[model samples]
Target: MNKATLASALGSPSAFGQSQFAFMRGNAFEARVKADGGAELLRLVHERLDPEAPPPKGGAVPDLGASGPEGRTARTALALREATGTGGWTLLDHPLLALDVAGSPAFLEPDAVVVHPDGSWTVVEIKSFPMLDGSADAAKVGAAARQSAVYVLALEQVAAHVDPAPRVRHTVLLVCPKDFSNLPTASAVDVRKQRSVTRRQLERLTRIEEIADSLPEGTCFAPDLPPDRLTAAVESVPATYAPECLSACELAFHCRDRARAQDAVTSLGRSLRAELGGLTTVGSVLAAARGESGDPDDPAVAALRRAAALRSEALGGVAAPRAAAEAVPCP
Candidate 1:
């Protein structure tokens, strides 16, 4: 089994060293939601997704069956930490955290952890990309920050159980080399904003818990459900909605096929933007489809309309049928 795929499927950790894909499939099906294009697409994606149905010939060379320089970067980070003999912090690579919320649960895990002698703790997330140049993009950094916040929230639980020293608050991402031969760079991060966002996410998480609690008895999660199903549910997002999820999303072949059938959105999380139906998209929809009338006299809505219009006009028609109306012109 592809460990990265399974970790993604089961909402488990993304450890290169770990080789487990047990609950991935069942978890994937169970994670289907109407908002995310439903389970049918997920099933279709999974069914058609495998590039390598046959087992790979290589022995232990491919850790977790992950690919690209990013995969090696993750594995090598583990090796380098041990090689450096750095013991100040807890090294949690692709770790999973199960956070308790009044009986229901939420999970958060970051790639690495470092406990300073001064008692403060930092969460280390490893990504394979250059931190320099335009390599460190906003959306990617947001993803890293969002993922790291889970660790800090989970660490809060540890704080309650063990003797309190310093809270795990900061996040540090270790970016992979743009050039393979070069050393990986460490990018320190403050995910306090992520923490704030997490607070809101937990509110939504709590809602999901309520939904699950009301479900029928025999209709529990699938066979491949991870230890904490809720977190697993959150993480088991399929490639269709989350094609940019990770370096080794097992269902890529399927997702690419699906995306190719549709029009491409190359700037940032274009596909994901289509999926979420949030501010950016809603704004776009209003501008293009609705045209000038999409904006209410409300100042905020009008500004958004103007911006969407400007974007459409600037793109010179390459954007899309509806994407043209994304950010409308301001009044």
Candidate 2:
């Protein structure tokens, strides 16, 4: 069963939901950006990333029609190979690329991928956020960059199989509304660091088959099962929960409840959990802070003790204020 269904069965459905208005607005913005054979989008790419190349003129918008994801992925690969040998601009809209993730194939459809005149490819990300004074929210930009990096990685996989592999640029084009207006603006964001990090993290994931083999016999996650049985089945699979999971995972609430019940330090944040070293529980952290336990030679324990001492001294030195009349001098 999917995490959402499991969560609903456990009476802990996800709290995060997108508003209809925001959804509609995003769709409209993307349409405008990709309208007219992606003329405006192509122009932006030429202006920002490939200024020395000739301006794009009615670039080829190949027909990527196919029945299913598999068909579409094959069609997209064919179109990309055909476009690579040419010497003109080509915009591939919603191309499906297959990436091998942890010994499994995962399909990804990027907003668009542009084939440059020099046979280089650039990923494009369209967002509804407003870019004020040529700048958008840093957090949103970072998120978009990370997402685009995944697409780049997928594109690279396709490139590797080609006779003459095309270069997938590390920089992606981000399109957004300009200064609270509907007018589109573009920016070039370098995602080399994000790509490297994502590639490393994905490489580190354990194969799904190995994880499944380790599970107990007959450990089913069917939502129709009784609540206790379903919960037990879920708990059988160990999970590393962090605060960021609330946004990305459907079972985050259930995991959060479990973490809090166990006084797990990860319920606070991943960074704090990493900094705490061997202290995996909030009780251990508190005990260390109070000087009741933990080795003094440990850096985490030593820092906690120093902070506790400073807090106590600050609280002890706090003096009571005088009466208002006494301070005012009868003025």
RMSD of each: 17.0, 6.5
Top candidate (lDDT)? 2
* lDDT for each residue of candidate 2 in 1-331, tens digit (9 for 90 to 100): 4788789989999877769999999989999988999999999999999999889998999999999989999999999999996899999998999998889888999999999999999999999999999999999999999999999999999899898899999999999999988989999999999999999999999998887899999999999999999999899888988999998899999999999999998998988888889989987887777678899999888777776665556558342221111111010
Assess every candidate by TM-score: 0.42, 0.92
Q: Candidate 2: list runs displaced more than 4 Å.
A: 317-331
State the weakest 10-residue window (summed lDDT) of model 1. Answer: 55-64
* Candidate 1: tens digits of C-alpha lDDT, residues 1-331: 3445544554444533332452453233233211132222222222322212222121111122235544543443343233222322222334445566545554444544443323444555555544565257777787777777767776665555444334555544434333442334345567888887876767565454565566655443453665467334433443343445445454344345444445433223555454323334443445434454444654555565566556766887466646645443343
Clashing pairs for model 2 are none
lDDT of 2 at 57: 96
Give candidate 1 misplaced runs (Cα > 4 Å). 1-96, 101-103, 106-109, 133-135, 171-173, 178-180, 207-209, 212-331
